[model samples]
Target chain A: MYQLTTVTKRYQRGKQTINALEGVDLTIATGDQLVVQGPTGGGKSTLLQMLGALDRPTAGSVSIDGTDLARLSEAKLTKVRAATIGFVFQSFNLIPTLSAQENVETALVPLGVKPAARRKRAAEALQLVGLGDRLRHLPSELSGGQQQRVAIARALVKEPKVLLADEPTGNLDEDTRDEIMGLLAGLWKDRGLTFVLVTHDSSIARRAPRLAVINNGRLKVTERTP
Target chain B: MFFTYLRRELRRRRKAALVVALGLALGIGLVITVSSVSTGMRDAQDEVLHSLYGVGTDLTVAKEAKAEEGGSAPQRFKIEGREDGEKASETDDRLMPLGGFDNLDDSVVDKVAAQDGVATAVGALALNDIKFTGDFKPGEMKKEEGKPGSGGGPRVGGGGADIETETFTVMGVDVSALSVGPLSSSKISKGANFAATDTEALKAVVDSAYAKDKDLAVGDKVTIKGKKFEVAGIATADTGASTSNVYIPLAQAQKLADADMKGKVSKVYVKADSSDAIPAVKKAISENVDGATVTSAADLAEQVSGNLSTASNLATNIGKWLSIAVLVAAFLLAGLLTMSAVSRRVREFGTLKAVGWRSGRVVRQVMGEAFANGVLGGALGIGLGLAGAWIVSTVAPTLTATTGGEQPGGPGQGGGPGGGGIAQQLGEGAQQSVDIALKAPVTLSVIVLAVVLAAAGGIIAGCFGGWRAARLRPADALRRVE
Candidate 1:
């Protein structure tokens, strides 16, 4: 479960103050899949950054599983990001120099996992994402869809409590996008994990059980889908 | 775990890593080569100095402008200088009544020998008035002539005039005390050395090189000041060092120079009990003898060798500083290269931090790569230094010179007037050593220092790059690249 109480985030760009998220308030219960829909520069990614403990709010608090993210130190925040949240970017940020399995193993390095166990867990994660035979394939050697699958495998390798995807299907073809959406929905239902997807596309937002639209730096609840 | 990531990065960017390593290596090589060459030159100069003043003779005592020989009343010879006057003029107060030029009394030698640190003291008279006579080829004497007045060598004839007799440098030593001094048995090359029991007969020993060139063997008779002397033996010395062609008894040399310096020695070879005691002995000799120009062998060595001390100083000071500047530049170059590399990979590091990597871990990764590069550079530098030394030694040029200590055929030397052979023979002191090869042997300490420097350069470069990496915010890094 996560909760945000009027969280605000601001940045300084050459003497100008830009409000990334202005006193935004939101909350999601356990096992909730909230899809945040927004136009370009709508602060949806900023909101996701706060929820995932990647950035601290200028004001207000973000509570995930009853622990306030804004009050946590940088060290504790990193720990929370490691154990509680997983991120998937639209660019499929898989290290190009590493193999698919090695990319997944990166998530386990900071956790002090032994190499043997880390490799075993990484392989299983890749297999779960239908990249079982692509263990040794580099990002450049794989298709865009396959690279996205590898990125997803890397995020899920740690078995985090929440999954944060920022336009995960924005770079994929329609057929590959449908497959990825179905896969994410199936994982959400089977594992009862909180899924927060940030996207500007209404087609992608329809797949979520709950939808929220963001304009400027403010958020509003749109609809609840069954 | 950091090593795992770093290893991959290095493998992926091998060309860049090699560049950084080579830059550091070049700096290290230059440092080692310059230091070693300078150090080697210093050592070689010391070796030459050790031979010049006689191996164990730590101090030498002489009278200024004093080795004057009497023609009839024994007071005609004296070097022309501010301290010396015409010994022939009895009214001149500057000229000592007796033993004017380089001639110090036996009593002064005894006093120096009795000093606290005095091990053994012997006396020798430098006489450059003598010449070797044998069947000679015409023009050979002119070709084998030594230059005069180099490194304060004996003053030959005032001007130029070839004498019928080709003159040679000569030394008169106390026969009984020669055993305990620098002219020990080791200096004898053939026949036998002058023994302690050898009386003051007409006996003499010729330097081996002079003996060979003159075809004069042991037991051959030679004439000095018209007095015949039996050649007792042959001796050899280092090429650049000053050694008279003939070594005669102290009494005979005194008689040859004349009555003015009679019963006195030209140079008192004092052997100190220890090297550290030379200074104390010098101080003691100065206090004991009046008007004596007492000089330590070290000072004499410096005075005798041309441009050696200056060259050593320039290399150690100027060359060392230049090498240090190069090393710093090498460090900065490596830093810049690594910084450029890190800038290009900012996104990779940003992703790593977003996952779970701490800032310290990333820093360690950078430093580790730098350290590796540094170690590789050190290895390359050492190899380069060795190769450079080899090339220098192999391509060195040979030089011929002489060590001229005394010239006797001057205005009043043994009453030889207008005889210019002294000027012709004075070039003997300019070491005839053709072996001018520079030995730049790399020492262990220098090697260790160079290796350490290489590693330090790499680590310093890594620190610069790591600082930039640590400042990178994960949010901004993620947004920079696709």
Candidate 2:
């Protein structure tokens, strides 16, 4: 479970204040699929980052599993990120030097898994993403769509309670985007994963069980299309 | 976990790691080379001083008159006063001047000889003059015909009427009583046996007469200042005393030099049976033998050893300073390179931070990379420095003229012939060669330290860099086009 109370993130740009997110309050429970949809510069990514514990809100409290994120020490927050949250970046930010399997294994490093078992778990995660044959391939060698799938595999490898994806299919073609979305939806349903996705495309945003529209620095919640 | 991080860091920044290693290698190599050279110089000095001085000498009875005048030639003084005066008068009053003495009374020799730890008591005589012989001159006919001989004649290029010879000192030692062995024999016209005869026989030989320039050899007929005798044998002294001296029986030397007397010996050599006896023996000699100054081999050795040690210390200090300079330069260069590399990796680090990696881990990874580079570079530098030292040593000229050889240049001209110049040059060359050898040993330790420092430095730098990187809001980092 995640909750945000009157969170506001502000930045200073050469003597002027820029409000990236202002007075936003939101919550999501287990198995809930929440999508924050907005145009570029509408604070969708900032909201997702705050929810994922990757960034601290400038002026409010973010609580995950009832632990105030702002109050947690840096090390404790890192542990929280490692144990309870997973992130999927739009660019599929897998290390180019690592093979697809190794990219998945990177998440296990913080878990203190022995190398062999880590590798074993990584390979299994890749298999779940239907990239079993491509485990040894580097991210550069994979197609854009396939790299995103590896990213998804990495996100799921830790089996975190919350899966946060930022424009998961932003770089893919229409057909590949749909395919990735289907794989994500199936995993989310089967594993009862809590999903919080940031996207600009209304079509993709509509697939979520719930949607929140962000305009300026405020959020407007709306029901799912179905 | 540390090793794994190190491995990954090394793999990721292989080039930077290499640079650090090279810097370290250079520093270590230099240290080893310098130390070796310093050690070698010490050993050479020790050998020469030890061989010449022996364990210790009891009484150096230089003539008080000559000591006052500061003449360079060797002199002697007589021991006098009550037998207890030998023990009681610690002052210089007991010394009596005795110059050019060849033999002391047998009773005097026996008296000192009876003292505890007195190994052997022998008299010595020293004389310096030009040596001339037939080999240095031409035959009568050749002299008339104008052919130059091996003889360095005074006349221009003819077995000249007279020959000019270099001034040489003949030091007569009691070969029969010598405790130390000969170092070389080419310069000794007669074998050492010539000096091994009894006192009377030696006296008879020295008292016989012969021609001034007669050629002599083992078994050949010869004479000392007109006293005739058959040559017995020849021998050489140690390098320290090699410049002067032909060894002969003490009686023979006294007879030849016309220096036999009742209460005189050139100097009394006293050996303590063990090191502990030195002080006591010296005390006895000082008390019993007036006008004699006692000295120990340890003191002489220390004097020589000190000179070498000072030189070595200077060299090592110079080397250390040089290494420090190099390390500082290396650190700066490495720091600049690391900073640049980190600048380029800002995005990557930010991604890692975003992916749950801690700032400390990022710093460690960077430092590990630096350490790897340092180790590799240091090994290489060490190899290069040793090779350089070896090559320099091989090509460099000798610093000193070895004993028994003519130094190639004039005295004080480092390039001079048969003088201190050669030894000095050789020493300098050795110093330089060792400087090269030192590169590796010095470089290795330096490199190891440097690399470790560099890694730590890199980590600190990277920590600051990583902290800055981690402070960035992820959305801004991801949104930046560059």
Candidate 3:
């Protein structure tokens, strides 16, 4: 479970200051998939960064599974981020030199996975995303859909509690976008893990059981499926 | 994990890393070149000193004769078993410190030879002021200018050399020790040595340099002091300041220089069987020969021979400073290169920090990369040093006391390939060859030192790079998003 109370994030560029996020209260239950829809510069990415422990809020308290993120040391916060969260970026962010399998294995590296087991686990993770045959392919060698699948495999390899994806399928075609959406829905349903995705597409938001729209650094819920 | 990152990183940025490695190599190469030359010079100095001191000659015995009151009337004698009336023999020759002009009795050689610990005693007339037959005048010849390594160490045969004024260090020895005594180290480059048994042939064994200058060879007859001598052989010796250019029988040198000096040797050099017998033999010689001064090789190197001492000092001190300067430059060059690399890889390092890698681990990864550069740089430095040393040595060998000491009535004075000046008035001089051997002083110790220094330079650079990487904030780094 994730809880945020009166969260405010500010960005200062030289003399002028911009409020990226302000006065936001949000709660995410365990095993819940929430689709957050927002216009450009509405601070959805900032909210996700705060929730994932990648950034600290200027004001307010953020607690994940009962521990306050603001009170944790940098080292402890790093451990929390690695252990409890998975991140999927819209751009894929795969290291060009590494193959699809190595990209997945990178997540397990910090977990101190042994080489033989790490390789086997990485292959299995790729196979879970229907990319077993593309295990040895570099990111550049894969299609946009296949590349996003490799990114998803990397995020899911460690089996984290929360998956924070910022426009995960925003760069894909409509057909490939639907394919990635199906994969994420399948993983969340099968593993019973919480998935929070930020997107501008209303079609992406309509597919989620819970949905919210962020505007001017404020959040307003559209609906929550009973 | 650090190793894996290091290997891949280095391969990816090999061009940049090679720039840093090559910079370090020049510094190490310079150190090697300077050290080898310095080391080579030191060895040559030792050789020259050893030769002048003579082989197996533990003690050199010479009769010291002079008056305390500045007059010849009063003399001091320290002979152990001596009569009360006997006075010291004094000579007017100030340049010859070995008392070559003082006609000591022939019985002194016998007395020294008969000592208990004395292995063999050879008496010689060390006449340094003897003139040769070629020079036209005294003041006409100055040092030849613009020659490589022309001036250094002590000048051979003292400082007052006039190339036009024919002069030679005439060391008339007992012919037996010519090949067995001090001259034994003299390698004969072209011809053989004069027969040790041949007593009186008035034959000369010339220095190879002198032979070349004079166009002299075996069976060639040359006249000095109205008497002609056949050139017997050409040989080389390692005599630095005391290098003798002419060697003849003791009897002949005595006859040519002074008819009244027969059966009188200026110095008797005694060789002990071993180092242990040196003190005993010295004691015996001191007791038997009155007013004799005995010197060993170590004493000759330290107390005497200014040229040898100067050469040794230059070799040891100069080389050390040169190596240090190069090492400092190597460190700075490598540091600058690695630091630049750190700045360029800002995003990469930041990403590493963001991905659950600790600050220490990131620093270690950077340091490992620097260490790899050290390995490559060290190998290149060693190879470059060796090759550079060889080239420098081949082109122009460094001057030692022996090779540069002789300025002469030089080996280039007469003959000039076709022969010019006729043989002049009667004088005594030796024609022993001048042999100088130059080699690169690249020892195992020097190689190890070069490698260690190069590696240390890399480590220092790595530390700086690590420090810079460690200071990077992961959040700020991740903001770059590259």
Candidate 4:
């Protein structure tokens, strides 16, 4: 569970202080799926960054399970991200040189998982992502959709409590995007993870149980049935 | 995982790695070659000094020849059975002490030997044998110029006369103390060495070149100042040139020299107790022994000239600076290239960091990659350095070293019958030189230095790249919106 109290994030662009996020309060319980929608440069990603523990708010506190994340050390925040949060990027940011299996295995490395167990778990995760036969394929050798599947596998392999994704299908075709969304929806429903996704697509937001619309560093939320 | 990532990254950027490695290799190869060649130059210089000063002799003591009043006197030849206006043929051989070095009292040896740090001192007399044969007719006497000792006597001129001259050097040795003088660097190529008891036995050691020139061997008789002495041995100098043509007992040489040289020696060879004692010993001798100039091996080395000296200077000066500059450039090049490599992998590093990789871990990965490149470069550099040294040792030209000596006598000075004056002969006597083939010997220390430099180069490049990787914020991954 996450709680944000009047979180405000600011950026210094030259001499101008740009407000990336204004005073905003929000709450998310465990297994809740939230979709954030906005136009480009609308502070959608900034809010997600604060929620992911990737950046700190200028004012107020972001607490996960009553532990204030804004007050934790950089190292502790990294531990939180490693053990409790997983992130999927828009570009399917798989290491270009690593094979599919090796790419998935990197998430387990910081967890101190033994090599044998790490390898076995990585293979099992790839199998769950329907990429078991493509384990040795590099990102360049895989299709765009297949690469995104590998990224998804890398994220979920650690079994984190939270999954933060930014534009998960922004670079894909409609068919590929729907396929990846379906896979993510099924995994989220089965795993009961606290999922926060940022996107500009209204169709993806329509499937969420709750939607948050952010524009010019301000936010508004509404509850809806999927 | 670290090794696997390092190996894969290195493989992906093998071209960059090779460029860095080759740059380092060039610097390392030049360093090794220059070092080896410098060692060769030192060895050659030692050989030259040993040939001049002889083995076991750390220093030498000699007095510079002082100028005589009204210049040197002209040579006079006495011809028996000579009639006025009639042609006469005569031959004369004058065995006199060499002119450049004046005689020092025999007690100077004892004075030098008694100095602190002086192990022992032995005296040697250097002489020149001038044999002249000519046919001439006595001409009318004329009043000479205002030079001292120019007697208006029968001047041999105006007649068909030809004079032939032959000159060879001779060194008188202390038979009992031969281990510290010119003979120490020579080996008896044929015949036996001088026995300790042959101090005044009228026996002589002949140089191989002189012996070969005169068709003389051991058991053959050599005449000096009309006195015949049996040749006891033929000595071959370890270096290219021998110190003298013949060696006789010191007492016998004093007997044959002028009356003033009766109980004197031209040179005193001194051996110090240790190399570190040479400066003190030289100082002691210079302070105590009046009119004596002390010369150490280091002083002699400074006088060495020709290709060996030039090569030594080049190796130490230009070669050293060039290697240093190239090494610095190589290090900088490697650092910049590694930093550039890290810059290109920013997205990848940021992704890793966002996936819960600590900044320390990311830095280690960059460092590992750079270090691997460095190690690979080091191995290749060693191979290149060894090959360079081998090529130098095998193909370098022979280097010649000439000792600095006094200028040859000017024309019309000490005018002889038909030859240059005795002063010119003496000047030639001091100019001894030898040719040495250069050999570059690779030592363990040079290889160790190369290894250390290689590792240092790698770690330095790693630091450059790792600092950049460690500074990347994990938010940059999603912030870039790629």
Model 4, docking class:
medium
lDDT of 3 by residue, A103-214 (tens): 7887777778897898899999999999999998878899999999998888888889988787988899999999999999889989888899999888877767788788
lDDT at A21 for candidate 2? 90
Scoring only the A-chain of each prediction against the true A-chain gives TM-scores of 0.97, 0.97, 0.97, 0.98
Give me the candidate number with maximum TM-score: 4
In model 1, the fraction of reference contacts reproduced equals 0.38
RMSD of 1: 10.6
Better of 2 and 4 by lDDT: 4
lDDT of 3 at B305: 32
Instruction: Give one digit per residue, the lDDT tens place, for model 2 in A1-226.
Output: 7788999998788999879899998888888899888877788877877887777889999998798997888777778777778888888887776789888887887778898998899999999989999998988899999999999988888898989888988899999999998998899889999998888777887666699999888998887557
Span of 10 residues, lowest total lDDT, candidate 1 chain A: A200-209
- lDDT, each prediction: 0.73, 0.57, 0.69, 0.84
- Model 2 ranges off by over 4 Å: A13-16, B1-20, B23-167, B170-322, B400-482
- Against the true two-chain complex, what DockQ does each candidate achieve? 0.50, 0.38, 0.27, 0.68
Over the stretch B1-482, how does candidate 3's per-residue lDDT look in tens digits?
A: 45655776788789978877877787788788778877776566556545655555566666555634653332122222113323322222111212212456778888888999887888777544323222122222244556678763333232222222343455577887753344555666665677767667688776666676677888787555556777777766554222355667777777766335678776677778888888777777777677777766555444323444454565567766766777787788788788888887776665445445667777887788888898788888888999987886687544434221222333322222211110000011112222345556788888998889778878988998998998886555545552
TM-score of each predicted structure versus truth: 0.77, 0.65, 0.66, 0.86
Question: What's the distance in Å from true for residue B451, model 2?
Answer: 8.6
On a 0 to 1 TM-score scale, where does candidate 4 land against the true structure?
Answer: 0.86
**TM-score of decoy 2:** 0.65
Best by lDDT: 4
| Candidate 3: Cα lDDT at B140 | 26
Worst 10 residues of 2 chain B by lDDT: B428-437
lDDT of 4 by residue, A136-192 (tens): 999999999999999999999999999988999999999999999999998998999
Candidate 4's residue-wise lDDT over B273-299, tens digit each?
A: 999999999999999999888989998
